[model samples]
Target: MLANLLLEIGGSMSTLGAGIGAGLAVIGAGVGISGVGGRAMEAMARQPEIFGKLQTAMIIAAALVEGAALFAIVVCLLIAGNA
Candidate 1:
């Protein structure tokens, strides 16, 4: 029916979209953390004396990025639940 086509009922597209978004957030977070770790290690290798400071800074940066990603994932989950 035209109405059925125009107005979707029991649609799962929103849920699917939200799920995809959440997955992307997690993937992005993983990539960000990996980059941070790799770069921090590379910097430390270049200058071994500053390893402690570099490591501490890297941890803080990674935690902030991860926290943001977690927030995004939680929001996506809530949206999925609502859908």
Candidate 2:
């Protein structure tokens, strides 16, 4: 009975951990994207002639951050499922 209780508790903890990890990942992605966008806009303001280049770079960077965040979220979900 004790073993079963411990197992259940451990499983619950794992699910909780996964949830926390996913939330943190999302928050990190948001911060990263916002920083990138703000910097890109500042750069464009400094030199409008290269607005296209700055925009392209910013989009690429933001996409990469998003991809990583998605991957992290998926991993968390997988862990939650397994637990």
Tens digit of per-residue lDDT, candidate 2, span 15-51: 9999999999999999999999999988888999999
Top candidate when judged by lDDT against the true structure: 2
> How good is model 1 by TM-score?
0.86
Scanning candidate 2 in windows of ten residues, the lowest lDDT window is 51-60
> What lDDT does each candidate get?
0.89, 0.97
TM-score of each: 0.86, 0.97
lDDT of 1 by residue, 1-83 (tens): 97876445444777788889999999999999999999998998899999889989999999998999999999998988886
With candidate 1 superimposed using the best TM-score fit, by how many Å does residue 31's alpha carbon deviate from the native?
0.9
